[model samples]
Target: MMQQSTIIIILLSLFFLTGCWDEQLLKDVALINSQAIDYDSENDTVKLTIALVSGNSNEKVPTNTTIVSAEGKSIRDGRTELDKKVGSELFASKNQVTMFSRKLAEKDIYAALDGNYRSPLSALTARLAVIEGEAEPILHAETENKPLISDYLRDLLISAEDTGAIPSVNLQNTLTTLYDDGQDIVMPRLKTVEQKAGAKLIGTALFSDRRMTGELNSEESIILLLLANSKKGAHRMTRKVQTDEVDPLYDYVTVDVENMKRKLRVKKNELGNFEVQIDLVLKMNANEYPGDDLYKRHVIKRLNTQLSEELTKEANIVLTKIKEANCDYLAIGRQVNAFYYSDWQNIKWKDVYPTIEMKANVDVEIIYHGIIN
Candidate 1:
């Protein structure tokens, strides 16, 4: 009797099963590959630019992109204007990259991104960047050799993140860090190159809370990421160890970090002040060293000492920049709070962060060399 009733219930439930009610068809709406926000000082309004990806389906490269723009007071308002200009096109589930102009980023980046955070449909996974100039021009950048501006820029940023040249970040984590007192955020910086025919991932933009506090070039950015232990893949760097060498090529050495061990400590010392010490021990494989005397013990030992000093000096420079900007990408504040709550509560972090004594030491060891070496 129970089996018969179960069978009847299963058969009756199938009758009420309905199809997908929220399914959106591809042909009806355009997919946004990239979106850029710029401050229009003349109009005192925000300009929104989106690269709608529409091209040959068979080709791998994003060859064709339809550029669209709208101006309004805010991101959602701008999107509303964009909707009226192009019917049924406020969707951004497929968005890959989001860019903000340096002017806007310096002013109030949080305001520009507020709408996207509130909306559940926003592209949380999209890569974020700060543009050197108007972000829209990068979207309008035309090139014959590359894919669509959106695709090209996205790939460039992803590759940079992989190499630890830029921070791996998105809109999602940015929101969390913006409100956190412990740490600040960093985003990749982008700019047009070669007369607007192409673009380049320049470096990174340092942020305190919501506004961009400072900028770091490519090398400085890489070193910051390394010190923070935020590197994703192989950290390969070429530095001029032999500065006085006659040949430029012979002056430099290229090494790939095989393994890295980093230690960061935040302690309140006898002086009643906080101090941070970062130590990095890196094991590297030499990819290129024109002098090529790795077999000798003294040569390897000397090179090891040279690379360590060079990296430590470079790290100090970058750390000074970070401290000057008051950008706490290392989350030292969090460590202090977690470990020493009394000290954290006594001091206002914003005032103390810049004044804190911080030091970085990097030691590099070349474990192996390429065949030529």
Candidate 2:
């Protein structure tokens, strides 16, 4: 009798745990894949746009996505307006991307993101970006091959980050940096092109205290990514070989950055000025040198030195911009806080960063010269 009762209990437990107990049916739910927020300064209102997935998941690809927008006093109020427009209740658990227009981002990013922060269903890791203009058009933009706009944008962002063209930023990273006293956030920049025919990734937008302070072009962004010692796949660049331009056979050489290591240090000099030094050790492959003699050690050494100098120059430019913006995206303040907490308490980082002495040192090695010499 005890064995029979044990078997019945086991069967009941299995039955209760078998399927989803409170799962909402797909037909009753609106799964959001992307969201965009814009602010209207004239009327003091917020605009919220969401891209919602539709159709059966049993099919290979989703059939379509519908974009809906609404305006209200705040994001929550705007969301309520959106709910009234769409028949199904909206959910952002599957959101893959979130974007804010420059106007909205500049005004107050934290205010715009308050709903997401408070909501449990919000996607904390959704890739975040800043759009050049109104963000609604980007979600509505049609594609020739790829049907889903969110998937296309997410893939493009991932590809750009992997190629070291941009720094990866998501909702979680943004919030973390915004809360941290030492670091700032950098987000990918997007722009609509040709009457919303498509979208283009312009560069990267740097934020200081949740406000858009500066931007880095694609080239500058790569240098910043390298300075940050971001791990990525091989990044390629073409540089003039210092060869005579008149009859140059190999005027330009292509270098692939296989790996890079960066070290940053903060210290006080004898003169009582704070100093920061950044050193980058880079392993590179000469993919296209054109010259047959590039395999020679001396030629390789010269190329390495030249590349190092060029990279250092670019790194300096990045540092200059970082200083100009007064945005410590490099986390130099963290070093100060850890080592010199008393000094940090007295000195204002924003004021000192502009005057601080910072230098970039790059060490490059040409690990390979391709298969054919």
Candidate 3:
């Protein structure tokens, strides 16, 4: 009888602790999905805008979002104002992306990212990008079938990154590169489309230290990715080639990069001349060939040779831009630190980078033509 009475007492105690004592309800929490920060340079103020999914759990898919904005002298102050603007308590743990206006990115990227680091529940893995104009406008942009702006932006970035059109940069990656001495950071650029009533990924913004130095167009961005030997899923490129007896300067052919191998080395020649050599080998598929006679051995050989030359030329152009920006995204500085410690210690890398002898040797093999060929 004593044991039974004790068991009943324990069961009754468990029932009282079943529900959360300090739990916050979903309906009373505003989950931030994305945020955009714009800076007023003259006043040294920040305009922070956030997009939050409407806490409407009744529907199968939440189709609406809320936009709230606040301005203050600092990011933390802005957050306080943001709390007053929203109906429910603000939560940032669900943030999917973060954006900065071009002016803000150029002014101080590290400052813009400070809040991300300080917040314990901040979205550390959120995608980061720079907007061409004001950052707030992106929150209100139309997102067709994709109801939420955050979902649209996330998918857009993931798609471009997978195809090697832009570099994959997130909060953690950006912070890592920004802090690393030997490397720089690159972020995708976003701009509003006036006619389409939406936004699109434009190019990529290159950063030196805490400021954006330059931008690379879509084609150049792809070339940069290629030079970095980024792992991509079915990378594709369209190049112009001279057709047989064609009067036009070139005809376009689209090729799918089936397989790629690259080797980079920094070494001193017999004459003690330092050089950086890049050896690239690509197995490609002629996905779309406008030229005639695809099966001809001479034509295949000519195409292969032209492709290799064009890639080499493109690599040179990219290197020139990289040198001009003086942003070391190629990990060349890291290589020097590892292999040429004496030289690295003796000479400043920024001064020697532009003068360094860099060469690209490209070899392309056309593994398959289209099924029609």
Candidate 4:
């Protein structure tokens, strides 16, 4: 009789644990993949757009997605509008990317993203970008071979990072830098091109204190990332060095950045202003430098000198742009505060950055050629 009672109790326990009591069915919720936010200047409101998977996973095949937009006084308000319109539970745990319009980014994206990061279940690691114009259009842009706007843009950001064209940025790290006094931030710049025929990743957007300041092209961006010592993967460059004016092909040289060593120092000058000194040595492999004798030491020396001068000129131009925009992508202010606490407390970083004198030098060393060399 005791054994029979024990078996009956075990059967009852198994029955209670058969299924999850609070499992959310896919058919009852709309899964959000990507989102865009724009500043409605005319109405003084915020516009929010969301691309979500249709809420019919069990009912039918969900090949099509529902792209919708709503406007309200604030981001959360707009989110509420979307949820009411969709008429289903809005789930965004799988969100891939968040795009901020140029206007919103320029004004200040720190406030615009508050709704996204406030939730503990938010996709904090979602990649974000500053659209060159209204971010909505990119979502609707025509793509013959691409999957969707969000997927294409996410892949583009990954490609840029792989080539060392932009620093990897996500919603979490951005918030940290946005609040930091010493470090500014940078983001991927995306734009629609040719009457919305396609979208392109033009370069990187420079930010100062969470506001977009300026931009740098793909080539210039790689150099900037290298200077920051944030190489994502393989870094490659194709430059038309001053090799031969007659042979246009010979003017082009391809190289791979194998390694780099950067040093930054901050010192108070005699004029009582901060001057930063940056020195970088880049080791490169000569990939395509034809029409020259690779076996001869003298020829290699000339190539090295030419490349060094050219890269130095480009690096200085980049530094000038950074100063003009007052974008501290290098985190120089952080270095100062960590090492010179008293000096950091006295000087306002925003004011000092624009006028701060910096001496930047880049030297290119071609340590290896192909096997023939």
Which of the numbered candidates is closest to the native, going by highest TM-score? 1
Query: Against the true structure, whose lDDT is highest?
Result: 1
Error of 2 at 130 (Å): 1.0
Write model 4 residue lDDT over 258-334, tens digit each, in one string. Answer: 88889988888888888888898988888888765767888778777887888888888888988888899899899
lDDT-better candidate, 1 vs 4:
1
Off by over 4 Å in 3: 1-23, 55-57, 243-250, 268-274
> What TM-score, over all chains together, does every model reach?
0.93, 0.91, 0.90, 0.90
Residue 112 local lDDT, model 1: 91
Q: Which residue pairs show backbone clashes in model 3?
A: none
Error of 3 at 264 (Å): 0.6
The reply for model 4, stretches above 4 Å from the true place, is 1-23, 55-62, 243-247, 371-373
Question: All candidates: CA RMSD in angstroms?
Answer: 2.5, 2.6, 3.0, 2.9
Query: C-alpha displacement of 257 in model 3, angstroms?
Result: 0.9
Q: How close is candidate 2 to the true structure, as a TM-score?
A: 0.91
Worst 10 residues of 3 by lDDT: 243-252
lDDT of each: 0.87, 0.85, 0.85, 0.82
